[model samples]
Target: MKILKLEKGKLDLFASVVQQFGEVHAPTEHEGKFSFKRLNSWSEARLDYNRTVLPPRKYFLPPRETLFKYREATGYVPATEDLEKRVVLFGVHACDIHALNILDEVFGKGYLDPYYLTRRKNITIIGIDCTPDEHCFCRSMRADFAETGFDLFLKDIGDHYLTFVGTARGDDMVIATGPLFSEVTHSDIVEYKRRSSQKCDTFKLDLEIRDLPEIFELEYQADIWEELGEKCLSCGNCSMVCPTCYCYDVADEVKLGSHDGDRVRLWDSCLFATHALVAGGENFRKTRSSRIKFRFYHKQRGFVAEYGRPSCVGCGRCIEACPVGINIVGVINRLRGVEHASTD
Candidate 1:
């Protein structure tokens, strides 16, 4: 509940102070696209970025991570990240925050993925509000706002920013650098509310959120997948840009003529034809249509059964990344219409 005002002028100084905690990773533009990268100074960070090409999850769950390294004679050693090291992730959006929470639940619930969870404990998240574009649909997925799960949430209030403290780590940072912040003014409160409330109107997604799960359920047998299969190139660009897609494939990389090697976990996708293939060449989701259907169903329906909610935060990165313009909202809406026809 701790909220402090950071004057627009002192933002760089504040970022400099925060950088003492760890390396600051923030949005930076290259070739007219935004992506998160390690910053040398506070000035290099872009808090006003529209969206990052890849979500900050790459810091936690890397695209390629070594699970363990082994030797021919020796057993094996875990090749996890440096758990003691800290990194300050700055300028994360609301949908990405929800995506992180989903990963926390997926990895922390039962198995307690030591590698991911340990690194998670060492990192700090600093979320910032953004101006949604036509592709943003986090509002429909109820991920447009986040009050918890992050260390600090930043809101732009015209002249200054309101930093809402969500965790003890965030509060501690503020308390340690007490001189950087000032008492919140009455004007600040009014402006923050005005901006946050009006942000909803900026999103362009017009999907029916509640009925989407049922539509996906009843339309499991729908022929819409055929259309998607035809449109989809199976390049896996959608899953790569997605903030919540966690499918991975494990491989053992061996040295030439030696038994010593490293077991690595690489990002995987259901769109790949061989994702469901086994040693004996048994492919369950063999058809392109079936793979396309499984991806949508897994995100919208199967995930609900396991997590009590759909996994999609609806940031619409997939929509923007899809080469053939296979939009998630359009897909869901099509299923809704097809399901209605089936019942009738």
Candidate 2:
């Protein structure tokens, strides 16, 4: 929990120093949007990006990954490709880091996913403070600031960046840069608090999360599901872009005319028609309405029952990614009987 300061001019030098630890990946502009990719240089890192098309979850639980390789002689050898690779994810937003913490709970408990856990250990997260946009409701979801689940976190405080060391590795990172970082001053603390208050006033979206699970349960039979189903393309764009959506499908890719095969897992969505299909072709959620309802219920209600919090981090990726302009904040307000949700 050590707080320090780095001059804005020295940020590029700090970024270069962290490269010795691992491959530095940061938000980079691509086709008018931003994505976390390997930075060719410090200049490519877009620290002020609003949001990425895909969250950093792709780094830990990849879109598709080989689980194991099978053969006649040696049975089911665990796939080790890229599991040991060290990566440094830089300039991550607070909500995305919170989403990773939620995923850690899901994958680290009950059944341990070595693939994900291994990558999680190898990857270093460097979180950065962000200004809330029109679509962002992370403050409502209690994810506007992260207390854990990051190695280093940076908050802009005028000419210097207030850096927080969250873990041992983060301490090592600070130590690695000889004189780049300096002790925080009283004025620096004042500047941080002033900006924090300013950021709070800028949120354009808000939602009441208290008693939300109960509200979702009461509205389970409401007409909104059908309305959303009609508009939803079942494209799975929301889940794909979501930071905490962890649904996955596993299948064995068998080699032609041989027993050799590779078992792989790919991202899946509850919205998909085949998601609920079973052995006898009996789908539990056959209708689009039921599928859509299940998606919301599981995140808002079911997850609360298990994890004490909704899985939705309120990063607004779902709101931004929905092609039909389905805004989650609007839906929640409508469900609560609010005539018009305030996005001001």
Superposition error at 183 for model 2 (Å)? 0.6
Give the number of the best model, judged by lDDT: 2
lDDT of each residue in 1-344, candidate 1, tens digit only: 98997887887877778887778889998887899999977777888888899998898888998999999788898885565678999899999999999998899898888888887888899999898887888998999999777998888898777989999989988887788888899988888888878997777666666866777777777777888887788889999999999999999999999889999999999999999999898999888888888898899998998998899998889988989888888777677663322111
TM-scores of all candidate predictions against the true structure: 0.95, 0.98
lDDT of 2: 0.93
| Candidate 1 residue runs with Cα over 4 Å from true position | 338-344
Determine which window of 10 residues in candidate 2 has minimal summed lDDT: 335-344
